[model samples]
Target: MEADTYTQSAFEAELPIPRGMARIMRFSNDQPTNHVFRRGAHYWLDLCLTPRPEKARGCYSERWGPHRFERLGEIFLVPPGEALHVRTDAGDNQASIACEIHADSVDHWLETPLEWTDRRLEGGLDIVHPYIRSCLSRLAEEMRHGGTGSAELAAMIAGQLAIELARYLEAISESPITGGLASWRLRLIDERLHRGGSTPSLGELAELCSVSIRQLTRGFRSSRGFTIGDHIAQTRIEMAKRALASDDSIKSIAFALGFASPSSFSYAFGRATGVTPLRFRQRHLRGRE
Candidate 1:
C-alpha cells in the first residue's frame, strides 16, 4: 500500500532498506478518526513510539477477524494480503515507526515458505518482543537523524529485524506458549483491577488480554505460579489492609472494594489473613499508640 493510506498520520521520514522500507508517522488529531489499511504485498511491522493516554476514551482498535486494541510500546504486525481497519479516538497524539518488508525477504530470512494459513503467522495485535522492540527503536533513532552511513545502518537494522521476526514466527509456530502472560498483559490486568469500582470479571480480563479464559488461566498460572483468582483475592486483601489503616469504616471499605456486604468482606479478609477487619485495624491503631 502507498504511504498515503495512513492519512491519519503525517509521514515524517522514510528509509528504503534492502527489500523493504521504513517510515515514521506522527498522529495528532483532535477528533476520532478511522483508517482502513488494504492488504499489500508486504509484511507490516509497526512499533508505537509514544505512550498511549490511560484516560483516553478509546485508543486504537483493529478489525482483523476479531476486534482488538493495542497499547503503548506494543507492536502490531500485519501479514501480507491481510486487510486491517483501525480506529483512533480523539485527542490522540501518537508516533510510530513502521517497517514494510516484502514477502521475499521474509521467506529468505526464514528459509521456508511463508504459511499464510497458519494461525501463528496470521500476525498479532499485541506483540511484546524485546529484540524486535530494540531493533525498531534503533531504526527510529536512525530515521530521526540521517547522518553519515545512515542508509547502510538502516539496512543493517532492517536485516536484523527481519531475522528476529523470522525466529519469532518460527518459535511460535513450532511450540506452544508455556510461559506466563507478557508483562504488558499483566500490567493491563493490574490496571483493570485498580481502575476503581468493581473488580473485573474473568471474561473481561480474558478479553483485555486478547486470549480465551482457559488460555489466560493457564498462562497466568504458569507465569505467576498462582491462580488468577488467588492473585485477585490477594490484591483485594492488600487493598483492604490499606483502607483499614485509614479512618474509613469497614463497611464502606467493603462496599468500595466490591464486596457484596461487610460480613462477606470480613469473612474473606479473615479467611485470607486469619484476622477480622476490625482486629486488623485495632492492631494497627495499637501499633501507632
Candidate 2:
C-alpha cells in the first residue's frame, strides 16, 4: 500500500533493516481513516508509540479474513498474503513504528515452509508478546536516533525479531487460551520485569497484556494468589540484589529499577529483606571472600 493512500497519517521516517524496512508514522487527522491491503507480500508488524487517550474516540477496527477485532495501544501483526481492512478513528495525535519483513526472511527463520492454515499465521490485531515489544521498541528508538552503531543494532534487532516471531507463532498455536492470565501472560510479565531498564508502570503492564488496568490486577491476583503490586515489588528486589552484586553503585541501580531515589530504594529493600542494599552487598562480597 502506498503511504499517500491514507491522508490522515504521514510517514515520518523510514529505515532499512536486514531483510525488511521500518517506518515511523504520525496520525494527525480529525476524521476517521480507512485502509485496505489486498494480500501483501510481506509480514507487517506495527507498534503504537503514543497510546490512545482514555476518553478518546479513536480506535482501530481491523478485519483479517473472518476474524475481526478492535484494539489500541497494542501491536498489530499481519502475515503475508492476508487481506486486511482497517478503520482508524481520529483522536489524539499518535505515532507508530511499522516493520515490514520479507516472506523469505520469515520462512528462513522458521526453517520450514509456511502453513497458511495455522491460526498463528493468521495474525490479526492486539497481539501480545513482550520480547517482540522489546525488540520493536528498541528498533523504533534506534531509527529515531540514527547514530554510529544504529545500523548494526537495527540488523541485530531484526534478526532477533524474526526468531521471536517464529517462536511466538509456534507457542500460541500449541497453547490454548484460558481464564485469568495464561502461562504466556505470566511469562510476559516476568520477561518485562526482568528486562534490565526502567520498570514498567501498572498501566504499561496492562497494555502489554492487552487488558485494562483493573482487569490485569484482578486477573493476576486470581491466578497468582497475590497482587500484581506484590509481584512487582518482589521482582524489583530480586533485580536490585543482582545489580548490587555488580560493581555498579546503589543510586544508579535504584534509578534504573524505577525507584524514586537511593533513600526510597534503601527503604524498600530493607523492608523486603530486613537489611539495606549496602549491607546485603557487603555480606555477599564477604561470603565470596
For each candidate in turn, the TM-score is: 0.57, 0.55
Candidate 2: tens digits of C-alpha lDDT, residues 1-289: 6454457667878889987899987766356656554436788887765443222211222323334433332566777876556666554455678899887776776755655533343333544555787788778767767799888878989998988887766544323333568767877997999786777889999999898999899877655434688768766775686677779999999999988899999999876555588986775565344
Q: Which stretches of candidate 2 lie over 4 Å from their true place?
A: 2-5, 53-67, 70-73, 121-124, 174-289
Extract clashing residue pairs from model 1.
none
Give all candidates' CA lDDT scores. Answer: 0.68, 0.68
Per-model RMSD to reference? 14.3, 13.2
- How many clashing pairs per prediction, in order? 0, 0
lDDT of 1 at 180: 65
Find the candidate with the highest TM-score and give its number. 1
Q: Give the TM-score of candidate 2.
A: 0.55
What lDDT is obtained when candidate 2 is compared to the true structure? 0.68
- Quote the lDDT for 107 in model 1: 64
CA deviation > 4 Å runs, candidate 1: 2-4, 53-73, 117-123, 174-289
